[model samples]
Target: MVIFGCVGIIAGCGSLGLWLANRIRRRPVELREFLMALSLLDTEIVWGATPLPEAFGILKERTDAPWQGFFADLQDRLQRGESASIAWNDVSLAQNSHFCLKHEDWQVIRDVSKGLGRSDRQEQHKQLELIQRQLALIKDQAGIWSEKQAKMWSYLGFLCGIAGVLILI
Candidate 1:
């Protein structure tokens, strides 16, 4: 029973560490997805000349979860007669908890909502391009940080588990 309990403790700690590491790794992937979705939105707005609600509907259909939800909510808000800027800002804030992005990423997103749908296609395109660039930089940094810290977090948890077992024994 004693040995089993120690093993359970070690396993639990190791699992927790792995989960945290997985979260770190997911951030870059999520950011990349967001970047792709933004590119799609740009295409819709620039070339297709789609309206905001229609573009958001397309995004809601094409994107994965979290992003899909974000666009869906934005589309719904727009359909309900809310201003584009308000819809974007409200959706971004309301769905903020669902995303794995960092503070800087959120800041760029917030900036995006500020000018959305308030300007001509040229201005919107420039704004979206700028946000995409910022997000790409953040994604690269997150990828590097995840590669370094994920292993450290996993090892730290296992080491702590081992220390606990040693002390108890």
Candidate 2:
């Protein structure tokens, strides 16, 4: 009974650590994929002239969850007649926000979301290009940060679990 209890405790701790580490590891990849989705949106808008709801619907198809969920939520909001800025703010930041974007990233997007369809086509293109550049920088930073933190978090969790077992013993 005692041996089984100890094994369970250690395993639980290690699993927790691994889960935390995996979350840290995946964040950068999520951001990168999000950038791709945004770029795809740019393409559909610039070339296809697809409206928000349709463009977002295309994005939802291209992406995976929680990102897929983000785009779907956006589609829903747009269908509900929410403005681009409000939909983005409410959906991206408030709802389905498992995405761990930095505040600056959100600000960059939120700022651009405000002007989404208000301007002429050429102006909207320029705004999108600018947003693309900002998102690129964010993607790069996320990659760097994730590389640094992911392994550390994982090992830290595993070690903490072992330490917990040791303390118990």
Clashing pairs in 2: none
Which candidate comes out best when scored by lDDT? 1
**What is the per-residue lDDT of model 2 for residues 51-132, given as tens digits with 9 covering 90 to 100?**
9899999999999988898889899999999887778878867743686666776777676686787776667778888887
lDDT of 1 by residue, 65-133 (tens): 989999999999999999998888888889989887787788888888866899988899999999999
TM-score to true structure, per model? 0.96, 0.88
Number of residue pairs clashing in candidate 1, backbone atoms closer than 3 angstroms, sequence gap of 3 or more or interchain: 0
At residue 121, candidate 2 shows an lDDT of 61
> Which 10 successive residues of model 1 have the least lDDT summed?
107-116
| Candidate 1 residue-wise lDDT at 128 | 95
The list of candidate 1 runs beyond 4 A from truth reads: none
The superposed Cα distance between candidate 1 and the true structure at residue 59, in angstroms, equals: 0.6
Per-candidate local distance difference test: 0.90, 0.79
User: What RMSD does model 2 have?
Assistant: 1.8
Cα error, residue 146 of model 1, in Å, equals 0.9
